[model samples]
Target: MPDTSLPKTAADGDAGQGGGPVPRSTALVLLLLVILLWGVNWPVMKEVVGHMPPLTFAASRLLLGALSLLAFAAATRQLRVPHRGDLPLLLSVGFMQMTVFTLLVTVAVQHVPAGRAGILAYTTPLWVVPLALVFLGERVGWLKALGLLVGLAGVLVLFNPSAFDWAAPPVLLGNGLLMLAALIWAVNIVHVRAHRWIGTPLTLAPWQMGMAALLATAVALALEDVSRIDWSGHLVVLLVYNGPIATAFCFWAMVTVNRALPAITTSLAMLGVPVVGLVVSALWLGEPLTLTNLAGLGLIGAGLAAVALADTRRA
Candidate 1:
């Protein structure tokens, strides 16, 4: 839940009268829309990366996303640099959340289908429970502990030797990178909890995105031949949808959702993202569905649900 102590203007929604909380009905709609934006982008990224080199694609998406964020910041007069002390926070959060995570997923998706990559990446939430226990000294209840175990089993399922081709370098690297992306994202989530806010987070977002874009571009230029990338109808669609709608606007929606709903409630509701990602990938990318993958997905979803339930009760 938002701090009740926040000013009414900060907490009120468009439909609210006298600066009150958003109606649950309105908040629910906003949550679903954000989830859809996140879920659908998986296939969009997969499709774009199919034709474009992964690093180049990653750099372009982050650059366009950075531009979109900067435009929003400028429009709202939030376009100043962060204080010098906050530079470290910028580096840590920006590196893990945007740069490293995006680059890994871009490469990872070249081998893993969009659906599998989405599931593996969303494991970020599952990884958070243990990190919280260790770093924040938060106690895990029996439910959360068991949920974590089930999640571990799901990871095992993904690497089932009978089905998975471990000898294939791309296959191995893809899964490994996805797991690394999840772990680093988990680290960033914990860091976010420990950060002391100096300004509205939205103000810092453009800078963080810019940092990611610059780093990705540097890497892409050093390793990739950019001249091979070509423009297309599909590429045009991908740039608009992924950069502006999915990355920029969805982030804005997330910030508002945080103020409008309970923290645990929001997390639980957003779990719909990976599920939608899996389905859309199958439909759009023609990613084959194996029984093993479905079983793994089910276990992961169950674990996340259990953890969310325990977290909700604890909160």
Candidate 2:
């Protein structure tokens, strides 16, 4: 669902670079849309996955999401392919961020509650700190180090041995996949932050999404029974919501909001996504909320804020 997260960048300013500033009221509204569409999608993703194979659902969303973004790109005259040297980075980022994350989370939600799955997936910022330190030559000061600790501690809380069934294969499988998904996205984010931009984020978005769609569809065909989907109006609505609204429009909103708001403000706002996911899942899907989950989410969100603020200072 588009990381269902905000990117850490005040450096890449192409989204609103020349458009002038957006009104605060308008920007705030758009930011809410970003959180609501993505946060709500966790439960929606869970429900739709119940009606169809996860891989099939993921594949369909990727295909449609790519198409929707492509349409936007065409209309905006931002459609273009990357340079030859950019291919590897583009493919690698696209595969991990778009395909791998989606595939892993698709499988994960089958075994874990969607609320929990969403929290695990959003732990991506935690991975970014270490990976960026190693690969991007980014420095981690004391604050970020504290952030890293707090974030990992939250992850540990979620993985509490007393509460989680270590003996259950589904539990291990689901948690492992979700964490891996976050790690994969974190790696991508580091690469994105490190890369010398040959194109704007919006310009690169559709191509990467299109490439990911092909890869996901290939995997879905190889491993999943596509015929399992119970086709109906409900399915189409979910597909549209998950595809265009959640993925493409969410990206659009991120670009706009990132431009309109301070980078740290945007990053901090993103931390609310998981809370919304948790609450929506509780109300809509009836997923039980536990003290541990609540505490873990709070710590992770705080940790993420620390990291985002640290990155802002670094930038």
Model 2 lDDT tens row, 187-279: 665555444444655666788888889998998899988988898998889999899988777755655564454433444455557778888
Q: What lDDT is obtained when candidate 1 is compared to the true structure?
A: 0.71
Q: How many Å off is the CA of 62 in candidate 2?
A: 0.5
lDDT of each: 0.71, 0.72
Candidate 2 Cα errors over 4 Å, as ranges: 1-36, 251-271, 304-315
TM-score on alpha carbons, each prediction:
0.80, 0.80
Q: What are the per-model numbers of colliding residue pairs? A: 0, 0
Candidate of highest lDDT: 2
- In model 2, the number of clashes is 0
TM-score for candidate 1: 0.80
Clashing pairs for model 2 are none
Question: Per-residue lDDT of 49-99 in model 1, one digit per residue for the tens?
Answer: 867889998888888888999998899888887866456667876687788
